[model samples]
Target: MQDEKGILIVLSGPAGVGKGTVCNALREKNTGIEYSVSATTREPRAGEKDGVNYFFKTKLEFEKMIEDNRLLEWAKYVNNYYGTPIDPVLDTVNNGKDIILEIEVQGAKKVKERYPEGIFIFLMPPSLSELRTRITERGTETQDLINERMTVAQEELEMMEYYDYVVENDQVEYAVDRIRSIVTAEHCKRERLVEKYKQIVEVE
Candidate 1:
């Protein structure tokens, strides 16, 4: 049997669902996991560094990537484009380290189509009210933008049925543990590991 390939974990949900927090906690606990940083055409905000927060690119450069088919999945939001770069993710996965991608529902669906073996997990809030409160607590958006986000989030939440697992993130630590468990369980699938152990039981 060939060496086991790394798992590609695609996590998505509505805004304020704490996907980033859960992923960060998981990485903190397991240093071997890799998190794929998405490329974006949006300008970096204060304290955000290029390559660290996102691979910031100009509109023209982003369009070039789209034309070249370099992005696994790309989408326009507001006035800018955001996408998951294909090469980086493939490289990490090929090296036998799990790659976790936190993307929007649309991009996540596209990834599922492209990589059928990838694991798609949806992180949801305990309730819509709690989600709204969390968004407001961030205090980064204006009232008008916040309202728009809430509307968009409701629509996104409806797409959770498409995911392989729906994890309601009520507590940070608990959510992180659940996500880790899912990854561990997936790695233990008989279909993925059985062939390697077959020779051990064969009579000489």
Candidate 2:
């Protein structure tokens, strides 16, 4: 697989759909998919480090990055900006390493427009009721905030129709297995490997 360009795996879904949990589990398997850390203008919480947790940037610096076309996709939330840096992602795949981006649906859509060849997987809740339950169980958000998230989640879930694959997050392990399988299958697609065979046969 290293001989070919690495695949870009985009995992996204509505908020509170366990996208992070599934991605973390997949990484723990040591399957060699590098997780792309996002840049943000938000202040870091306790024990969070720059670059490892996120690339912390001042609002001024972040806006500059956006102006310079440094970010693949960006969005402002709660008065702060968060986005994926274009360089690290491109560098990883160009150097023959797979990269996984666990992002919001809006960002994922933007990434797809840039890299249509990328594998886009949407994580779904078992049911809308279940999604509400998961959000409510977080217990950290205020009631109004939770309601806002649910409204946003509804809109994000509708975007699933644009994705290449959908995996239900009924359980973390199961969702992880499904995602890994998608990546493995994508690597074997003939369209992606035809060039190597042609080169071996010396076809023009």
Candidate 3:
């Protein structure tokens, strides 16, 4: 195994399930990880920086990227286009830093189809009722939108079994720690770490 070939991780979950928060915590714990930034046709919100929060682009520009086959996976959400740009993500993964893609279930499914070796993690809420409560507590969306999201959450949750690991976002710290452990354990896989151990054992 090459040291420069880093792990590619896909973290997927429903809205308001705390996947972003957990990814932030995980990055803090492990500095070698890089989070993948998505490209979007949506305009940046207040205090959002270009290229950091997201790669903001015009709809025409985004459409060109889709046409050029530059996006790994693109989807239309709420009349706007969002996608994972392929080049930057591949660069980070090749540089020996674990690359994490925080995306929806559909995008994640697309990634898995392309990179079958990638690690997929599904984040979940404790239950449907708890998820509804969390979404409502955010205070960002109206009641009708919340209901729609809750229904979508149910569909996303049904696809959890497709992931390699499942972490429940019932508690923030616990969920982050569990995800970190998964990443660490994956690094210790026999195919990657056994040869190093063998070399050490043969040392004088």
- Identify the candidate with maximal lDDT: 2
TM-scores for the candidates: 0.92, 0.92, 0.88
Error of 3 at 177 (Å): 0.8
Report, for every candidate in turn, its global Cα lDDT versus the true structure. 0.86, 0.88, 0.85
lDDT of 1: 0.86
Q: Kindly list the per-residue Cα lDDT of model 2 for residues 1-204, writing each as its tens digit.
A: 227899999999887898877888988999999999999887786677898878999999999999999999988754678899999999999888899998888888889899999999999999888988887886756788788888888888888999999999999999989888999999999998997887877854
Writing each residue's lDDT as its tens digit, candidate 3 over 48-164 gives: 788887899999999999999999888876467889999988888778779888888888999999997789999989998998998898777789989888888888889998999
The digit string of per-residue lDDT tens for model 1 on 9-121 reads: 99988878888778888888974779999999987766788887689999999999999999999887656788999999999887788999988888898999999899999
Candidate 2: deviation at residue 97, Å? 1.2
List the candidate 2 regions with Cα displacement exceeding 4 Å: 43-47
**Distance from true position, residue 80, model 2, in Å?**
3.5
Q: Per-residue lDDT for 12 in model 2? A: 90
lDDT of 2: 0.88
Clashing pairs in 1: none
Kindly give the stretch of ten consecutive residues in candidate 3 with the minimal lDDT sum. 1-10
